[model samples]
Target: MSYEQAIAALNDQWSQGDMDSDEYALERERLDYERGEMMSAQDAPEVAA
Candidate 1:
């Protein structure tokens, strides 16, 4: 699944109290970092061989 979808599911879990605040915050931070990395990679210019 996409990062956006995963994050949304995580939000649902947190909202439902299936996860604690610490765990939710850690997971959300990781997901956000990963999403940022993916987007940065996509936006980077290609290098010539």
Candidate 2:
């Protein structure tokens, strides 16, 4: 899942009290970084086939 999607999912779980604030923040950070990495890769030039 994308970072934003993951974050939203986490938020849902957080609202349900399935996770604590620290856990949510850590997971959110992880997802955000993963999303950033994916975006960076997409921004890179494509290699010729």
Candidate 3:
């Protein structure tokens, strides 16, 4: 699934009390970091082969 969908699922889990605040925050941060990396890679200039 995409990062957006994964984040939505995480939010649902947190809302349903399946995850504690600490764990949810950690996971959310990790997801956000990964999303940022993916976005950065996509936006980077391509190198000449």
Clashes of each: 0, 0, 0
Candidate 3: where is the Cα deviation over 4 Å? 45-49
Error of 2 at 18 (Å): 0.7
lDDT of each: 0.88, 0.82, 0.90
1-49: candidate 2 lDDT, tens digit per residue = 7666777889899999999999988988888788777777788747322
The C-alpha stretches of model 1 lying farther than 4 A from their native spots are: 45-49
Model 2: number of backbone collisions: 0
Estimate, for each residue in 1-49, the C-alpha lDDT of model 1 and write its tens digit: 8997998999999999999999999999999999877777778747322
Model 2 residue runs over 4 Å out of place are 45-49
- Candidate 1 residue-wise lDDT at 10: 99
- Against the hidden true structure, what lDDT does model 3 obtain? 0.90
- TM-score of each candidate structure, all chains considered together: 0.79, 0.76, 0.85
User: Which clashing pairs does model 2 show?
Assistant: none
Model 2, TM vs. native: 0.76
Residue 17 of model 1, lDDT score: 94
